[model samples]
Target chain A: MEGETIVKERRILVAVDESEESMYALSWCLNDLLSLHTNTNTTVLLLYVKPPPPAYSSLDATEYIFAGDAIASMEKYSRDLAHSVMSRAEEVYRDFHPRVKVEKKVGSGDAKEVICVAVEKLGADILVMGSHDYGFFKRALLGSVSDYCTKHVKCPLVVVKRPKNV
Target chain B: MEGETIVKERRILVAVDESEESMYALSWCLNDLLSLHTNTNTTVLLLYVKPPPPAYSSLDATEYIFAGDAIASMEKYSRDLAHSVMSRAEEVYRDFHPRVKVEKKVGSGDAKEVICVAVEKLGADILVMGSHDYGFFKRALLGSVSDYCTKHVKCPLVVVKRPKNV
Candidate 1:
């Protein structure tokens, strides 16, 4: 082993959301991939992206006055959701890979852009995501995050699709 | 641990080709993913697809008579190419994952269909592929195999994009 360069650590970013599919992905990554991998230096990065604050175009004085309050409440709601999602992900990690280090990340912007940027900025070795399996029409309308990341993310990307029975 | 149910084995199907990208994928899967993973129960299935024999429709007696010989020679060339590709892949596996169990499979058809069918038939827990990174125009015209498999394959799909500096 002398003179041999050993990879001390690897960062794996897992994108989570409120959807059941995302949770399943986190569980699968932990139970099947992380737990099975012998690399003790692996760190799991759990990322949750909140949509950007809504823009209010209303010019009415009354509507403009309340816009700040409305935006504040929406931001608070987003923060709460992110926390809850991270907690759920942490629970799965604790159950499956209790010893592995886990980092929580919350980004606000388009999910696709935020995820791609995070992978690059965090220097993730691998990026794991859950596929929504939105059918043709819906996928076209909604734009799939995994699909975008597959094309844009610089690192290796894994898209886990939950089985129907599960 | 006596009564704990342990998964005896997992199948990881890796699609290979003559392209450097696919070879890079195989190496990455072995060195970065398989070598680090503690699971000794993993089995790698290497699948290679050769394009279907060319169709010859010649009404002339002389042309028809020569067509058989031409087709035979082409078939032989295809077989030889497949063998060469397999040998190259085996070499990589030997260097990186000598002890890991690897099964070689050669199928003749469209790569997309063959890969998807093989994944389902083999009950692969994960499918690893290399992205060609064909830009928009090229991808639109040639159709990316990884993109197709990502949408169709039942198991989790990992698309490894070789780092540009590498």
Candidate 2:
């Protein structure tokens, strides 16, 4: 390392979900991108965004118990899904680069906003995401997370699109 | 090298210009991003887009000679600029990573369209660009090459923004 340039540690944030696309992005970042930076210290941050809980309106006396149970169950499901996504992401890079540092964060809000804020908060050097490849009409109506982040994130962004036939 | 993944060659198209912002991006890609991919075969493609020659309409006899001279000078300038830009890019990466394979390409047209078409024609696995960081008003009016490429490029894209203070 005598002649090598050693800069401060760099953080790369990978936004993940249950979709295979996100997982593929994480794997690609590790196997294809992160492996080459032999001199720089890099930490991979994994972010899982849970959709905000639905609003529960005023419930009649008879409906109160059921509503409470439903809310609790939904919360539990969200927690479980977040855990599963993190676990899968961990399995990916850990297998590829055993020594790379990993961090986990779960945000509850609109993914586009959450991801943008997370990048700023974490001071990420780069943000990596997997494109959902939503068609023109669907993307227009629902909005794409990667597309939205591109306009808003302060740091560099890499949107990985899995090949259609792969 | 045993047990390492040796995938097909990867093509990374990096759009460059005379701007320091773009040069920073090329350095970042070589120093931080491409350095980590220890096993994969990667080629760095440097693309330079020259503004299309101005449309010269029919001119009166006296104007024709001067116009021809001006056109020749402008073409020479464009050619010289392209050469210098490519030479600078090669110097940066060669100093950083001597063995990294590099290819140069020059295209004439609107930057956005030429970049998008180049990615598709080259079958680039990834497209890397430097953001101009145009203010909201300017970006809306002039349009950004990186922004347009994000919408149109078929493969993954990375937009690197150089910090203002740096």
Candidate 3:
């Protein structure tokens, strides 16, 4: 006992979005990953990344193409969306394991970039995310945020797919 | 006790290849997923999918473009590769948990289709795979096998990314 070192608590980051795919991932993390003996002291980090606000050119700004109130409402909507996602994730976590410690984080930027940066900053042992199962054309057009994070994140990454019936 | 229902053994399918990424995934599965208390009755299916052999056109057949011996040797090489990958995975499994059950399976066809079909045929509850973390250009040029499987596999799919320094 004198020479033994204490094991550090594992940090697991789950990326939450508004889609059911993401909610299923949260459930999977709670049921499959966190409920394991190996994850006894794990801490879950619920993260939501919202796309950055649209940029307007100087000419458009001067012409008042978008009203100030409209821009304010759009910003508020994004914030509300992020908050709602985190709240739903919290409910799922509480339902699965109420005693587990969880932290909620929100960032506005490219989802891929925000996820990668948060994983590093949080020193996460593993990052969990849900895949939307986008087809070839859609994936090519929209670009896969999880795919990008898989390449950029330094920690082990788990991309969970939602079951069809779910 | 007389009325107790039997618990079904969980099947976990892991897609293995000749790359370090796949090997890392095998290691992670053994250490993290299989070592958990909830996985006591789990059986792991190690699958290796070899690309389909090149097709010979009628013109090529008439011209005798491919040497018979060369074609035979190439097929043998692919078989050998699949065998070696399974052997390596077995080593990893034994290193982590010697008592766990593991089965090796080999298929020839498009990697994506083979993996999806194997998961269904095996009735796997979960499919585990490794991501090579290919860049955007390479991924677009040569479609990712794991990406395709993630979208197509009916079971819960876990795509693991190896830690950068590891």
Candidate 4:
């Protein structure tokens, strides 16, 4: 305790997705973590990762050709999805603690890789995420983003599990 | 801020094991989380879950029979392992912040189930655990305990990932 200094402002980066579990994790962070530090400067960064667009293959060019307008609409849809998720997260944060500073960030890449890189780039003190609660068989089929992030992220990570009753 | 009551004492249950990841998690909790609340009542519960002993079967017991002394010594070893983990956690807490109230708990059962039950019974505000950082194939072959707890636990959870350089 002699030389140790307490951090006044804690940078908390929360990864958000379009799932109830993610929303629940955001709510918990706002209510339980941020609310407690009302007097301190706690910056909460809301991050949403969009999957990288599908790659164009030479053989697929003949089979599945995308129209110009279709590509534009698809890009627009991805942007809109990112905005919507951030807006919802902001709404929840405002409802819980309006005065707290929050920033929205959207990254493009694989979810796990993007999250880890963002945490490092942002210099976040802690990274909070939501568990999708996949079953054994389902997890085997579809990999877990949180699991990957937990191992790869440079900062401390928190993976929140939404209670069933909640 | 009007009429809002801040929780003074937050009970944080940290699940520790005989892994470097768990020790790193304990260190992070002390430096990042608990250090911020030195003036307040912050209770950190260090929990270690030992896998339950193998069930004995009569048919195969003829070839794989364990002596009475060996069984007693194995039980003793498990108990000692639990104690050693908790002691190490306590030492880390003491080294970082001695003022924080720290409690050690050991449970015998599946790691995931024990952690969830301990969080509920202890009325913990949050449960912090460490990830083993298994790769895709490794995790697929042997399931992750932290991943399981993240899905099953009722309270807020933090899965701390040790930095590569640290």
Candidate 5:
């Protein structure tokens, strides 16, 4: 960063699960991007992915988490979800930044598809995501979404580590 | 993974060089690990990071690239610079790993420290490497031996997307 100046204008598309995991990923991006920006025209999109609920045949006991209303009027729900996450994240961002313009959005579909769509649709310069550290058994049994995203996305993607517990 | 049973008995480490923009980090890991197995106990470590080069303000750019004997004690001369990267990675690892372990390391120093420490001292599962992708502004940067291996370690790491055709 010696003689380099920060470029603050790129659109940043981030996947937010509203989970601790997402907070970790978002913080890293916010912090790193903040360090590099010259306030070029940056907008942060916090995209939340809600995987469709599993059917009765599905082995997951947690299917209920995404049931009924979770999938109903997904577009409307996603909009609200995005708004909620961004509203909350905005408060945190203000604490560190005063001039940054941030926005949020919600989408429905497979995590990978949602992300891919967001990048193309939003013209994002970067995608920030968090990886859930799964146990050997769990990972072997179920494939990793984060790993898949790391493999598929075209833009500069970062699967950031969890932030330290301050 | 349909009917296929997952059996990761050994551990391998792959490092990804962080300094350079990386495009084919994982493919590189797969190529190397697919070939070797340490008694069926092998798992690949797709590493991609190394520490920064030690201050050689006294040494010229030529001296730094050709760091003579100080690098001999390490692995291949091609990957000599990676030796000092661990200083920047802020690595945090668990104490015990059960089966074939796939780990990612990031180092801020030179490339060798991350690879050597993970392979020779830390007992990495294997190593994989690849050159970074080149954009119009950045030319072939990750291909430097020291930079590529810095992202990988010993064992059987694979390499992919070594070419910049992309």
Candidate 6:
């Protein structure tokens, strides 16, 4: 960052839960980064966490809420979720920041862990993601992330809020 | 925390450094909260930690250095710094957030701690502040205060880039 334009060179990471809220956030992040006329490269990861396969039992209250050793079924679900999320993400990006370059990744893992791993692996300087749900927002805040990075990492982090539109 | 129409009810703790950059942050925070139209009562704490008076130095390079404290003079300088900071802070609030009920406290302590302590005692749900030097867009935030709040606190934080006007 020695005398270089800070906004011009940006590497952004957006975590996608395939929710309309997440897509909206990605849209804002992409457009805002490009608006700065910055060199922007975005890698969006559509992440899904698999709750441990529910104990298969007839007496289970929500017995059907189980994803058994159903590898084939899981793969199909993953592909479908990825397809929908990417389609929405791409559409939003095209509408807001068509010129910005983007790469996509889809995986199943803990949302926070997946994000932390991607940030490190990509050497991303900015992590642009959605405001978390009330439960998770407590720990996962745009504010908290920026604070954490500022204290520990020598990079910049931008946390974008979701627009009202779906 | 019950059913309510108040928007942006997140408690915002704004730290003022008495710098133009800080004032911009001050305005942005007020406007942002006001827009939410929440039961937003902003407590603006004007913090100014006076540098200890320079010891009568005969040595070279002493001009640029912070000479050790003149214990006797610390009280006078501290009092003066407090008055100057609070006056400026009031003017800033009157100009920007006239509707916001304001409060002032001067701590002759570290900037970050004073801010963190205020937030804890007041149950601030948000921290608003400004960053120091950056590039063309003075708001290209890469600062210690904003970063510190982001990492250590749980509330949502909004850091306004110092308005470029100044």
Task: Tell me, by lDDT, which candidate is best.
Answer: 1
Model 2 over residues B127-154: C-alpha lDDT tens digits? 9988777678998899878756766887
TM-score of chain B of each: 0.90, 0.91, 0.89, 0.85, 0.40, 0.67
Interface residue Cα RMSD of candidate 4 after superposition: 2.6
Compared with the true structure, model 5 gives a TM-score of 0.47
Pairs of residues at least 3 apart in sequence or in different chains that clash in candidate 3: none
Candidate 4 chain B: minimum summed lDDT over ten consecutive residues — where? B59-68
**Ranking of predictions according to lDDT:** 1, 2, 3, 4, 6, 5
Q: How many collisions between residues are there in candidate 5?
A: 63
Candidate 6 lands at a TM-score of 0.45
Which candidate has the highest DockQ of all?
A: 1
For residues B41-95, what per-residue lDDT tens digits would candidate 3 score against the true structure?
6778899999898765554564454556666888999989988888888778885
- Put down candidate 6 lDDT per residue, B1-166, tens digits, no spaces: 6785543323456677657767766665565433333344445544454544444648555643444434555677678766876677677778655556666655546566667777777776555666665543553443465545544544445555553455
The positional error of residue A47 in candidate 6, measured at the CA in angstroms, is: 14
Model 5 CAPRI rating = incorrect
lDDT per residue as tens, model 2, A1-166: 8997776798999999999989988988886677555666888999999999988688897787888898899999999999999888877876655567888899999999999999999999899998787778998899878767777887889988777777
- Candidates 1 and 2 compared: the better one by DockQ is 1
For residue A2, model 6's alpha carbon misses the true position, in angstroms, by 51
lDDT (tens digit, per residue) of candidate 6 on A16-43: 6666656666765554333333233334
Ten residues in sequence with the least summed lDDT for candidate 6 chain A: A147-156
lDDT of candidate 5 over A3-35, digit per residue (tens):
986544568787887666667667756764333
DockQ of each: 0.65, 0.49, 0.43, 0.49, 0.03, 0.05
Q: Can you give the TM-score per candidate against the true fold?
A: 0.92, 0.81, 0.85, 0.82, 0.47, 0.45
Candidate 3, residue B102: CA error in Å? 0.8
Instruction: Write model 5 residue lDDT over B11-115, tens digit each, in one string.
Output: 545565544333244432332222222234444454555334344457777886686545553434325544333322223222123333444444445555556
Q: Give each candidate's interface RMSD in Å.
A: 1.5, 2.7, 2.9, 2.6, 15.4, 10.5
The reply for model 4, stretches above 4 Å from the true place, is A1-9, A38-40, A56-66, A95-99, A134-141, B1-9, B36-40, B57-66, B95-98, B134-142
Pairs of residues clashing in candidate 2: A35-B36, A36-B35, A36-B36, A36-B37, A37-B35, A37-B36
- What are the chain A TM-scores of the candidates, in order? 0.90, 0.91, 0.89, 0.86, 0.70, 0.62
